[model samples]
Target: NVEATKTVVDLISEQMEKGFEIPSDKVITVESSGSSDNVAIINCCFGHRVNETMGRVVALLLSARKGRNIGIEIDPYRIKLTPASSKEVLEVIKSLRPEAVPELAERALLDTKLLQWKIIHSARKFGYLSKDLDLSRINLRKLVIKLKDTPIYREAVREIFVEKMDVEKASELISQFGKSIKIKVYDSLSPIGLASREHAFDLLMPGKPVEALLRIFRQRLEKEVTVFHCLNCKYTVKTPIRLIGDLRCPRCHSGLIACFNARRKLEEIPKKELHRIANLVLSHGKKAVLAMNTHGVGAENAARILSKYYENDDKFYLELMEAERRYIRTRGFWD
Candidate 1:
């Protein structure tokens, strides 16, 4: 086992050195198993430290660029309360972020069959039995909690939940329901009412209810999230910007006018025409009308604005010519 573990670790390290891009589908799946029919005894057989050491070694093995395909197999008992293994699992669990623990546990429990069995056996070791005395029937969200600071309970829960539930979803649910679990301080005359509140607190937090609600909400939201597309480029942008202005397109400078406030689709117009109109508007300033008594742009302002976007338009070119002639005539001295 030591040689095998070392070999796996070396392979992973070598692959990682080459810029960690393992073909997950092509890599070998490795695991640990024992010769025993009593799965619980088999799982519990490994000491906690040994399990911790193995988990660390296996984790290193999987760290190779192509090592994601490397799988760890332990019998149903080894992953639980056994001294070496349980401590190791807890160490790993502690290393993970709090938000990540629940979902990671759920995934391990649900997706990996042997891992799930190990979790169940560990739960039995900790006395977290269902009403029916079956681990399978127990509320997973409840079972996978800190039965207040004991490593045995902590490891058992973290591994189970992360293996079975979606971490993000679980986190959202836990936040939403956490307040309900708090005991309310009511000034009730009846001692029985206060006793009931204490009883409720002792019964446990609303973790399972939160999980159920999250599952329902997830199902409802799955169908409602739709992709929005950009009309001009025919690209599917997850959330497209709505056309608010009679603005020019940033990409092609096409006129973009919104058809309706409720929709993102817009109408496009030619860039040349838009520039021509803008130039014409800017040219018809205040001072030009008083001087020429003609519907033409002011000499000074038109020259400043029109020189940039319209170098070749007939109307703008004519305006520029007129401005030059006016300048020459107004100058008392000739050049």
Candidate 2:
């Protein structure tokens, strides 16, 4: 196991030394399951330290480049986040700025929706009107919030729907108002709420490798949750953006969701390159596993071997549905 881990680590280090591009391998797939499963571990944190899972993703990138098949497995239970109650987080809304809340969520590896609800609370504090959990129905009336009885913004009361705004555009608009009143506008846009979430893996479940791997799982598995509209009925529902999935509105059950992938949300920020580096670290660990893999699976099959274990995406759910049908045994309740 130690020798196997060392070989993959050397391969990864060579790639890292090559500056993100692993030395091109002529082999399309190298299938070898001779090594022990325990060889799947590695010592890497990067210049800044990375979790074991994060290292697997880094190894995956290398796997793709090297054509060296590796078995990457993931455990769904390791990455679960405890949901906080709405009221509990509402108390912290005032102390945190609209932009800073997502940072809090990101640091904790919490869902972006967690920050979404908090933004709504802060918006309400600034006297903006909202009627949705996601704050998709927010409206800012000019006179709703005033400092010393002065209108927050002399501009006509309007809806700066966050779905239609970007971070820079939102920031520019918010700056029209004074610093004291900036957050009100910021609240409306929910810039961080609408943007993509980038997980901070190393900090979560410190010293645990799977926690690190889950971070990479998040990046690869994360989907853009978008609002879809039914043009025929004028009804909308939020759903995932998928190339091979249906987007039907639950309300009408008659029309397909027309807005999948149509607009970028308020909180969608691009993953930093450092995060990619973190993923490389994750991939390396997986490579280590492959170096010692005893599974006897074919080469091409080795890629995404972890998919069955990591739960996310419609594919996993579909598999679950199939399992339930095949194994449930009874048709009715209380069998």
Global fold similarity of model 2 (TM-score): 0.18
lDDT of 1 by residue, 184-233 (tens): 11111122211222312122332335345444433432322222223344
The regions of model 2 sitting more than 4 angstroms off are 1-149, 154-199, 210-226, 238-245, 248-335
Clashes of 1: 36
lDDT of 1 at 216: 45
Residue-wise C-alpha lDDT for candidate 2, range 276-311, written one tens digit per residue: 322332453332122112122212223334333544
TM-score of 1: 0.16
Give candidate 2's error at residue 4 in angstroms: 27
